[model samples]
Target: MKTNVATTLAELKKNEKDDFYSSISFANEEIPLEQESVKRKLDKYLRKFSYLERSSHQIHRKADQLLPRIAKILKSYGIPDDFKYIAVVESSLNPGTTSHKGAGGYWQFMPATARLYGLRVNGKVDDRLDLTKSTHAAARYLKSLYSEFGDWTLVAAAYNVGGGSLRGSLKRQRKDNYYDLKLNAETAAYVYKIISMKTVLEKG
Candidate 1:
């Protein structure tokens, strides 16, 4: 079993390297690749790294396992598929993790935010650490922010910073785009980090 696993990993590595080289072609001092071809390569690499073969039921397990169920919940709530990454970013889809700042659960809500969103927060019980309840709260909050901002990126930004703060920054900078606006270090890199994690999880 060990030898087989090692061989499988080696094959996957070789395949990924092949995919990388095959997709890139240099021209006019720039690199370009056909969209369809690149996507095929990526899809192949992602399939090789699929979570279905893994047995370690930790963060990856939680994220991979819960996504389908969470998708259903989000669909029922009329939320977009993109919001799925928010739960992954929050607690790595783990229900047991807690931040030092007191954020908890798959959605990682602070005490105040959890309370405001109607998730119970107390010594005897902390529903902020519960995946289902927290995700529901997060979905609702994100939907409300989307209604206010009319942009998914802005809603993501507001999730990092407060909605009022993000709106103020947009007004001051005269740019509503999250990628273009100057934000605090944490908020600035937050979305990109989430995106990177998404790529890794979806492709690993």
Candidate 2:
């Protein structure tokens, strides 16, 4: 079993290095891999998630325990099940991971964002750390974003950089497409990370 897992991960890395990826997608939107830059960018994240982060074994173990609950909550809100990958990309399925900016929980919601989405984040309690509560909050937040952006790819981008910042970038750049926008480095690659996680986690 250990050897099989290692082989699978190694195969993923090898495939990423080649043109084995004939297509890529996010939120039902087909990524235009005909564009060499887009293909390379996504391939980089694929390698990062499949090989460079916590071991595939560790991430898969945590994901096995977490994604089902996250998926159920997202579906309850009428959101795409694919959005569960947001949690994977954000926190690597680690319920206790905290960001330097004080964002905590599986969904990585900052204090203000957590409170805005009906989560309590006071001194005595931080609902952002609760799996069920935070996943629900994240679903509501994603629904709100989808209403505004009307695109799951854009919603994913907004989730990382905030709706306001994404709107400003879209306006300044005169581009509604997430892939074409000149966002900050992090936001630009954010969707790709989610998609990468989706691909690896789902395929495995």
Candidate 3:
């Protein structure tokens, strides 16, 4: 099984490299492969010397295992198919993932946010660890965020930071565009990371 997994990953890496120069469409936007930002992210994922390259490899391997079921759930919730990569960015498709800040699960929902989205978070059962349930909760949360922001990129950013924080940023900065607003490092990189993951997975 380990050998098979290795062989599969090797093939996936080869395919990913072959398509590294191709553009990908997400949220009705075309991300040009030749763009410096895109190229940088691709390098970060594929380069042997980059620190994040190993993590990127693990993410793609996990994504290959998780995305089919996730895509089905996203479709059922009327969420954009590309939004599946949020799980890749959040928890790398690890259903049991927990963050230092107390977020948990494949979608990295905090306890309160999980409950707010109708996910159970009691001691007996943490629904956040249940991929299907957490995905539904994430879809609902994302739908609400999109309703508030009207931009998928902003929605992705807001998912990392709270919607209130994003709204406050918009108000203070007087700019509604996600790329235009100066944000904390993590929030700023959130959408771009998702896009990068999407590109790698789609190409692989």
Candidate 4:
């Protein structure tokens, strides 16, 4: 006898509804959830994103066009591919957007940061909007943060909250792990969003 996959799915869904209510009742009883027992379930929940498909064909096309040039520059400076996803999340391959705070371009560099990184800013031209130049600048900044924190997650967090801010948060939280730290909302979600975008885009 062959098992019907649709029937199995229906049964699983029924079981899931039962389990959800059961868990709710247990939670209301003030019982601590067993971390080990629920680890698989939590992993399954988070991995829902694994099915996400990248629909921005134009973004992929632009990334393909830009990545080789970006990678060549990063390689010359000894930077890592992890930084590429930052660009993916920042501008989605769009170079013309400016954040309300004045961050502009594919890498979204603010005016001060852009100037600090040796990018020129003028009335008519902002080098931060230049893809090749801004990517190289972001690489150098991320590399500097990596040297400071000695952790990729921390370095990535520093990109959002500033190295000084993350350093203070690390001390206050007593954890260097980015996911474990109580970061500002935007910074807290930033790394995970980047990872998710990269995973979907690469797989798609």
Candidate 5:
């Protein structure tokens, strides 16, 4: 019985590792998990992102309520449902949070970007603070990014680092691929973290 239990535990760990390191579809694109470089980065983030499992009770609870609504909104805009994880990445499924740069709410829309996407962001009415409005605003912004990058991975990167900055990096590095392009630390880790968060929420 002890030997059998040990074998089962080992098998479980192997399966969990495979689940973390295996190829996954993100934004309707197949990520090349067989690639060594991609696997390493993903493993690194999965190790760090494991904190979510330990300290994410509230996040998980809120996500149970919010993700379905976010999914419907993303689908209506023709976005892949995977993009809903961006909210988890941005604000950990918490609303009414603001970044130092003024990106706020679940989707983390900056005031200017929120307004550009047809959300009102003013003293009297900061629409970025509203879950439904901010999500719609995020969809429009992500759609614009997709239009610009023509690739979902690049679109996700552009969402993090700003389209213009991502474009400039692609031009300078001569690499259009998110994994290949040279980026700041935060942007470099952004896609991996999103993937990790998606795995955690879905697998749990």
Candidate 6:
């Protein structure tokens, strides 16, 4: 009887191990996981997910709420639909959000950068908090960055770290590609964050 009980316990353990491995394989299969770069980005996404998950849901809700207006504006400006996800990663679609660095509004534009992008950022009326105006300003700034870098990923990185800084990094690193250039942690993760948000929003 003891021998039979031991054999049964061994079978149960083997079955449990097989089940766990199968679950992991199923999850990876569902997500179609591939590429080292994507895996790295997904890892970063998971680290930030605890803090950003609720905000991500809020962003999706806000996207649905404002879709018509935002879509019309984006269409008028000739910006791609996917660019809306940038705003999600920037401010979670909350117009009143202000970063520690003084970037404010749905697109999280710093005062100086906002002013340069044709946004009025005075004491009384900060246009950065105005969703319509801020989206337009963001579109214009993104268009200019796209013009300079000619690559959306590089443009997104430059948007986070500024065009001059990105240019300097490219020159110093002797690498024109954004992925090849080493950058500060925030700037390096910026594009990946945007990509992750885009993926989530699309899947939703």
Off by over 4 Å in 5: 1-16
What TM-score does each of the candidates earn? 0.70, 0.87, 0.78, 0.74, 0.88, 0.75
Candidate 3 regions with alpha-carbon error over 4 angstroms: 1-22, 30-58
TM-score of 5: 0.88
Return the TM-score for candidate 3, rounded to 2 decimals: 0.78
* Candidate 2 lDDT by residue in tens digits, 102-159: 9898899999999999999998998988899999999999999999999888898999
Question: What is the lDDT for 93 in model 5?
Answer: 74
lDDT of 6 at 100: 86
Least lDDT summed over 10 consecutive residues: which range in candidate 5? 19-28
lDDT of 5 by residue, 1-204 (tens): 999999999999989878755545677677778788888898787767777677658878888999999999999999889999999999987777889998887889888888899988887988877788888989988999999889999989989999999999999989868888778999999999998878777766
Q: What are the per-residue Cα lDDT tens digits for candidate 1 across 1-204? A: 999999999999989977854643211112123455434544553444344325344657766788877777777877766568778767767777888987887788888998898899998999877767877888888888879998776788799898999999999999966766888988876665554445556555
The worst-scoring run of ten residues by lDDT in candidate 2 lies at: 17-26
Model 3, 1-204: lDDT tens per residue?
Answer: 999999999999978865755544567754445567656754664443234544557766677788988889888877889899888778878878888889999999999999999999998999999888989899899899989888887888898999999999999999967766788988876777777667656655
**Global lDDT of each candidate:** 0.71, 0.85, 0.79, 0.70, 0.86, 0.74
Give candidate 5's whole-model lDDT.
0.86
Give residue 148's lDDT in candidate 4 (0 to 100).
95
Clashing residue pairs, candidate 4? none
Question: Alpha carbon lDDT of residue 131, candidate 3?
Answer: 86
Q: Model 1: clashing residue pairs?
A: none
Error of 2 at 1 (Å): 41
For model 1, state the Cα shift of residue 141 in Å.
Answer: 0.5
